[model samples]
Target: KMSFGTGHHATTFQMLRHQGQLDHQGKRVLDVGSGTGILAIMAHLLGASKVEAFDIDDWCVENGNENFDLNGLTTRMGLGTIRDVQPQGEFDIVLANINKNILLDEMALYADLVKKDGFLLLSGFYTQDIEDLTDHAKPLGLTLIAQQSKDNWAALILQKKA
Candidate 1:
């Protein structure tokens, strides 16, 4: 069974809210660990020109595609990590709502995919984990610009330094 996002979790909600705050019009976006494709769909509705999403789980990839189809949106949903999926070029905005360990482990790759001065939004970690995340991000030229927390869950929006 695939564990998909229902937009009910604090992290997902915060991610959604953060995404809403940003202007996605005509932007190229990437949704890492896309789960049920909620974020990808939201990006489309927000006017992103291109959206690429992937997950390590085959079920998630399939389910996410189904969700996209149901929403009548065309999305590039694949099965694998960012390295395995190998999406080409940098994105105007990158969304990663995965856990702390995976976020840290793939931070460099994520940073590389963000266009200079573009945004990377992250969640799925505890509020206490923010410092460690930002710490790792800073050296990669990603600076924290916005943050939101619900209960113990947290989300951050970082910009790739131009």
Candidate 2:
């Protein structure tokens, strides 16, 4: 299988670091726009019991599946837009690494998929975009917990308040 970690932006690595510290043991995770499924694979490695990922592109879905298998991850991969997915239940953690526009548009939906006090990690935005994204997320019951940046890219970790 082709490697999925080739030549991506440095921000991805930063996000991975934050994800590493979280306790994924027996947790359920959802990875949206899971390009190469890297984040999902990482979640599995962190001891998540189950990981489900989706992408709008068939190629990404296929590659993500392959990567998951290569890493011995039990993650499920599917092809569909995030809006098309109807999650069976709230997730312990949610990872989204898509563009800013899509992130903002889907904020409410993402909030609903998170369990109370669950973690929501979002990337694919620049530093300048944080305020707008946070402002949009506020009404959805998400509060900013942390932020990380590399180069021009940024990642925000939000939590659903109890």
Candidate 3:
């Protein structure tokens, strides 16, 4: 199994557990703020044809790569900001486990990167922050599908309108 090798919060793992069985067969996936790249690796396990991950911290890029190898999953890693990273093409699914402010700021970009009817999964926010998050994302044509909360953290699943 892959380990974070740092005292990171358990929310990331929780997000993975709550991500129900998905049909990612031959799908394209993008993981933002990939950290240890657990989510990206999980995407591959779920049968994503291609998984690309990005992180601003170089250490994360290295650690993520290590974890990917540990999991025996192949993925592409890059150093880039969420605002600067352009999606090569529309993805079937996009996952962002980031803070509320950053999520709000980049919601439009994330929305644009997903194909119509594609899904966007977001975590790293509190349940109390959902209203603002939903408000920010709605204008971009995203609809909330489900929400999973643990303690103070919450994850939201959204789908881009077709």
Give the candidate number with the greatest TM-score: 1
Model 1 lDDT per residue over 22-55, tens place: 9999999999999999999999999999999999
Cα lDDT tens digits, model 3, 1-162, are: 333423256467556854554568899999988878878888888888999898888888888888888878766578888766676888889988878888988888899899999889988888899999998888899999888788778888888995
Between which residue pairs do clashes occur in model 3?
none
**Candidate rank order under TM-score:** 1, 2, 3
Residue 25 shift from truth in candidate 2, angstroms: 0.9
Which is the better candidate, 2 or 3, if ranked by lDDT?
2
lDDT of 2 by residue, 82-111 (tens): 778766788999998888999998888889
Task: List the global CA lDDT of all models.
Answer: 0.93, 0.85, 0.81
The lowest-lDDT stretch of 10 consecutive residues in candidate 1 is: 1-10
True-structure lDDT of candidate 1: 0.93
